[model samples]
Target: MILKDALPQGRITGTGSLRTVVQTVFDVLARFRQYMTHPGNSRFEPLFEIAMQKQLYNLLLEWLSGETTNSPDKVETTAVVASWGIFGAAVQWSRDPLHSTSEMMVHRVSEVAAAALAPVLGE
Candidate 1:
């Protein structure tokens, strides 16, 4: 429910860059990082993490598939890999003490994600 709301309006129909998808996801999880890391939620953290990753994967699969891309046939693999990268990074970022590297991390991940979806509309 919260995740759905974090997503951009009309993005469920996909039709956008991988960079945007990844950045949007990062923003959402970063906003809710406290919930996942709180002491009271420690017992359910492991299961929550797994479920979150799976949900993101499936959502990204559908979103990527709907995207109009140069490499239409590779969307499945791209989505799988990109989703993992995005989720993993967010988890690590959430645990870190310093946020000094946040923008750098996002840029780096966004670049890799953009590559997978390249010949992507803007570049």
Candidate 2:
């Protein structure tokens, strides 16, 4: 429930593992996509993009920093890489109408991310 605890109330609420975090991220991305698609909010798309990336990056940084036992440099690298991977996957998920839902996508992303980070983190 790390992600649930970290996110604001009503954004993402649940208790689980990395799937919870991925689902929360997907929910956030879906909300941002909705906001950006609004005609009045279109002008702020660039700012929203940056904010979303920063938010994910910070969240990953904090999460990985606590989860990993690696050195500072490795942890930082892993966090950056994982954040980008997760963010990129979320972006793609938003674009694909057929796969827009979080049910399968979130778990897949979580598995891939966990696999990628496992070796580096010595988990």
Best by lDDT: 2
In candidate 1, which residue ranges exceed 4 Å CA deviation?
A: 10-21, 31-33, 36-40, 68-73, 97-99, 119-123
Q: Per-residue lDDT of 1-123 in model 1, one digit per residue for the tens?
A: 434455566345433444555566666567666676677777777786787777767776676665555475576776677678888987787677286466677777777666754543333
**Model 2, 80: alpha-carbon shift in Å?**
0.6
Candidate 2 residue runs with Cα over 4 Å from true position: 1-16
Q: Per-residue lDDT for 39-117 in model 2, tens only? A: 7887886786677767666766666677667787887888788878987898789767474457788878888988877
Global lDDT of each candidate: 0.64, 0.70
